[model samples]
Target: MKEQLNSLVLKYQQTNDEKVFKEIYKLSVAKFHPTFNAIAKSLRASVDEVFALYEDVLLRCIPTYTGEGNFENYFMFSVKNKRANLYRDRKLRTQKEVLECCLPKDDDTSAATLEIISEETPEDTLVRKKRADQRQLIRSLLDQTDETTINIVEAFLSCERPTPTAIGKTLGIHHMTVIRKLEKLARNFDSKQFGDFRDYLIAN
Candidate 1:
């Protein structure tokens, strides 16, 4: 069954056959449902959300599989890394919301709603704005990097935090080379241009 699906993926990549692609996609969803369900259950995520992430992983990776290792293993690695990033983003949002809730409020205003608005300090507003700006800078810089560099950085940033050696093995580079490239990348993030992004990476 897996070999048949693998052939279908290759054929679809070659011929761009809508029917073959659809069949391969359907088989992928069915074949990986258990994996997705387990991840969703462990993360306390909605199954539908997890499945959507799985589908996205398929869209991005299937065309590039090239008959490499087990397709299931390849797909699993992609989806797992994607889920880790999703989890991290969700965690950051929750932390931001908690911080917002803890910000000091205004004391002098009489109307309750107006009082709430008046209570937030200029410093609090600046802090939130700076964070938003820093995130934008991070994304912009990530977009500017080469694909291989971006891949290495994303793998490093993922929840697994795979060692430089492990990442190097996956990317077929020397471990010291990976460390050097990351260090150079970090140095390129000038504080004048990136503001708190460099600090955020270091602090984390």
Candidate 2:
């Protein structure tokens, strides 16, 4: 039964025999009409209209069968598409009514709307090249430092709203130790680098 249906579907897809295809489809409808009719009624569509709506979908539905999902699955899927289309069509009609009632008037309002809709500046992109350079320098300097100092420095900067006490608690060190570690980082990396790297890390 499944193999015959599969062959019939393949033939329907490939064969240009309108008479034969119609004949086979009618036979299948005779066998399948009860299921299809129930589904049509559920969609609030007349059976003829439902069949017309399903023409393309039914064509696609052929391949989906694969003898894997049965008639019940196909029936249920067709019904689901019908229900979804009905809901979508209703929503679109409502939207069309709203749009017809209030069409856009002029360029000034359109310009403001465009300004609101336009993507904001891509995040930090203008400074990105300089940021990359700073990050490379930071990474290089830290690569020369001992691992513990590097870890402490990373933990310190990771906090956006950082507090000295919070960082001290995280590193299991005294606030003074945290401060000293940061103060000495410039010396640890390069004895004479820039202005206080410590100030960059400490919240206080």
Candidate 3:
């Protein structure tokens, strides 16, 4: 696979043919479709989004493909890095939306009031610290879980309209299993803290 991909890349570079580039794209998807699906599931992204990223990576990396090292590894590494970046950007957007909702609207509040609201109060600091501690606790619990369970939890929290059936289908598990695992996981956290943990997981 490595040698073949490298040869195709070399050919594309030599001729700069659109047809050759299309063949490269086709071969890449055929080889890496499973990887694309895995990344999409992990990030709660659609398959199309993952394919779009894959296409972008191919375009960006092909120009620099020196054929010095393993092309497959290089391509996959780029894909994984881009997936991480997409996850980070999504998290940032979620956090921003949450923060925006918490802030007073400009139309309803004066500039002085908005300024006051922007400043963190002592109580707000305390609340933030407590939430951080809760998140740490949740993270520890998650660390104890198996990879499948963690993936389940992430899918549950990140999906826009999450349901046990949908999550199970996405993860190739049964709906009943999804419910059971979720319930078992929820029991690990205190009833009051669970809400904060959910919010923390969703935002982070």
Candidate 4:
């Protein structure tokens, strides 16, 4: 596995060519596709539509192909959603005339099938929620630090405006105290999974 990943990284570095993706597809799809197709069909898509979407997914994943674990897993999430969207859109469009004839309503009474076709597993959704909560928690945590920490973080958030040196001076500390505290804030409060974005407060 390590060797294969190394080879892929080398290939990626050597050429940004699409053939590397084809090679990755050829190498990785032996046991992956059948299991993937089963998962998609289980999610309510028809077998034929699942396969068609699988082809499209392979093309999408091609650019990001790598000999890495769970690459296919992420792509499966994306492909399942794409398949669901395609099916829903096509179904709605095909029935447009019938729908118009049945009721002169602007919107159809029927609900979209996409509501049933969830691309994210319950675990994935929970993980995302937990991560978001963690980030919010981190922000709150930073707020509880000394006023200097809060001021520094707020300054970083202000993109156009200059950070007042007086915030540092008001703390009765050196100018570098702000920078050092920012690093400590990241260490103690920021998330490892998402990286400490105190470095990019202005980006918020």
Candidate 5:
């Protein structure tokens, strides 16, 4: 996929053709859809909202992509920055709401509402803790597995509709082999703790 993306990116850069650019966009959507879904789940935002932001970012960055660094890394860095900006904006909005609630108002403003708002975790802190937890979980899983298993795990996570057959196809293995590997992974790590392997993948 990386090689394919690099080729497409270079072609687009050279041609500056609309069709080439569209193909690049299509490949990008397929490759990054899981990551976008994961981001939306983490932020407690709608998938459509996340996808819209992703599309906007891609449009803004593609023309400027110098094809110097790894394309995936460049794209992901932009995504992380955008997610951070979103959290910052949310924090500001929450602060504004808190201040508005503190202002003297009519009987319509309830103390319970103020208490709830005050008790909520700050957006930045929540995002930090979530990312930390995800990293720790990924590390723990990696420690318990071999490189082949890790490859399977990654392929499974990357699939838009992650079935055993799809994962096998991605890794050039049999479907039953994919299942066996997953079962072994499940034994090594408590997949059920995260509701299922799919949920664990999304969380991470």
Candidate 6:
């Protein structure tokens, strides 16, 4: 592996051919697709988003390759770190959206009323209440599940964004078992309770 990576690196360095870069990029994608795809599945991101991130990570890693140690391992590490950052950024964006939803409207021109509702506008209050209700419904659904199912579901929903495969490894179960658990979770929640995210685990 080391020799192959070194050869690729030297070829790119000496010839300065973009084709070498392209070849290396393809190799990287093929080798690390599983790792990156798992991260995406864990985060419940679309396949397109994960592939886009994989490409970005590959491009960034290629320019900085030192050809030391295991190139595949180093490359996978970089991709995983990038995925982690993407997850964090996504979570932050979601939080920001929720906060923005809670803010007073531009034309909320009632001074005394504003004083009474200084923290949040009526619209914001309603949005938050709705979110709270949804959360409660989800919690109720989860409560009906067994311990293993609960653990599997929580792991899927974690910030770490562990894939079903990763969760299976952690729980000493088969990857297919993890997938089945997720399907069961989807079945547990009604479409109305889950809204458009009804089959979230399976969809991801």
C-alpha TM-score for every candidate = 0.45, 0.33, 0.45, 0.31, 0.44, 0.43
The models' CA-based lDDT, in order, is 0.62, 0.53, 0.66, 0.52, 0.63, 0.61
Best by TM-score: 3
lDDT of 2 by residue, 1-204 (tens): 545555566665556345544544544443655675786666655555454344434433643555554544574588568668965765664454422233457755653222222333444364455445445556777876677667776775566434444667787876445544544565554425544443344322
Q: Kindly list the per-residue Cα lDDT of model 6 for residues 1-204, writing each as its tens digit.
A: 656765675577557565676566557775666675676778767655776566545544554677677666777898779778778877865565532224445757633232222355566676566656655665677877778877776665552445555677788886556645655565566666555432243222
Write model 3 residue lDDT over 1-204, tens digit each, in one string. 678888988997778665665567667754677776777878777776675567556655776788899777788899889889988877765555422224556656634222212556575687677656655766677876778778887785557646555678899997556644654565576756355333443332
Local lDDT at 113 for model 6: 30
Residue 63 error for model 5, in Å?
Answer: 1.3
Instruction: Tell me how many residue pairs clash in candidate 2.
Output: 0
* Lowest lDDT block of 10, candidate 5: 195-204
The number of clashing residue pairs in each candidate reads 2, 0, 0, 1, 0, 0
User: Using TM-score as the measure, what is the rank order of every candidate, best first?
Assistant: 3, 1, 5, 6, 2, 4
**RMSD per prediction, one decimal?**
14.4, 27.8, 18.5, 17.0, 15.8, 15.3
In angstroms, how far off is 97's CA in candidate 4?
Answer: 4.6
Best by lDDT: 3
What digit string (tens of lDDT, one per residue) describes model 5 on residues 1-204? 766777777787677665676677677754677776777777656665576456545544665578787676677688779788776766666566652235446776555333334544576576567556655676687787788778877765555446555567778887556645655665555644654433454332
Clash pairs for candidate 2: none
Task: Give every collision pair in model 3.
Answer: none
The regions of model 4 sitting more than 4 angstroms off are 1-23, 27-49, 64-70, 97-204
Query: What range of 10 consecutive residues in model 2 has the weakest lDDT sum?
Result: 111-120
